[model samples]
Target: MAGSNFGTAAKIAAPLVLGGAAILAGMHRWESQELTVYADQLAGGLPTYCSGRTQPPRPVGERLTQARCDAIDAQTATEYGRAVLACIPADKLDQNSFDAFTLFAINVGKSAACGSRAAQLMRAGNREAACKALARGPDGRPVWSYASGVFVRGLQSRRQYEANWCLTLAEAP
Candidate 1:
């Protein structure tokens, strides 16, 4: 019977695994692809490049080919996906939920996303609350929309968008 349960689980998870390409394509609209390295003055001059990537920041004015940017984006998505998945059970996640969480992780770093109230609610099997938590916390205020202790409008918009994405499979008002 346990083997049968595993098979059932695999069947449920198959679509999510197969939807990787679609998710990647959908994410493009949310992530801007800049071929040249630039510093994000909004985030205290955080060096960024290649679709909002901010790791091993390249020197300012450095340029990369579209192919290289694509590669880096793919690699970063995969890395962040693994990190997010490590903290959330695969069995509990629909493709939309996973994509939303992965997007959040990409923006806020894996540790921050994984440790967030959203992740906690999801892990506790409360999908509705989890989606709402992405936008606001227990205080009924926006969360994760701050940079250097100041609220950022763009980040707030992104968080609300991600929250809506998370509610795709759920009935939300």
Candidate 2:
């Protein structure tokens, strides 16, 4: 009943609705735990950038190997994630939004994702626009070639996920 159902689609959707449903039906209670596991696998646990690491750069549909992405994800959760959550407004966020932002924060350093123009828009209460801003990517600069290895691809996906999560809040009874 909680957590926006890619992340699920991408990571564990099959189980939630199919085979995984039994184990994850009440997973809302364990989202934080799941995040730690997820962060440890994808983002390098806050090491700075995955570009220089031995792992392949993140791309859509890329399958992250446990050996490569695991350590990074944990490092990300420790370094940037905790701080980002600390800064996020408790009243303004839900489990799904929190999950989405945490993942985005991992993709683009906490400072970049949380303080960029995009995040500013979200904080100012314009998530619809903020979601659009997420894909704009560093003044429309090229992510791979820019000084900031901070491209907006992965973060954009997370943003869209967050947007979807937030959008649903409006339809809630």
Report every candidate's CA lDDT.
0.78, 0.42
The Cα RMSD of model 1 versus the native structure comes to: 6.0
The per-residue C-alpha lDDT of model 1 at residue 2 equals: 54
Clashes by residue pair, model 1: none
Query: What's the lDDT for residue 26 in model 1?
Result: 47
lDDT of 1 by residue, 64-168 (tens): 999998888888878888887899888767777788888889888999999999999888777778888898988889999999999988889889999888777
Quote the positional error of residue 58 for candidate 2 in Å. 18
Error of 1 at 171 (Å): 13
Model 1 misplacement above 4 A: 1-15, 170-173
Error of 2 at 50 (Å): 9.6
TM-score of every model?
A: 0.85, 0.43
The alpha-carbon lDDT assigned to residue 128 of candidate 1 equals: 71
Superposition error at 19 for model 1 (Å): 8.6
Q: Model 2 reaches what TM-score against the true structure?
A: 0.43
Model 2 / residue 24 / CA error / Å: 13
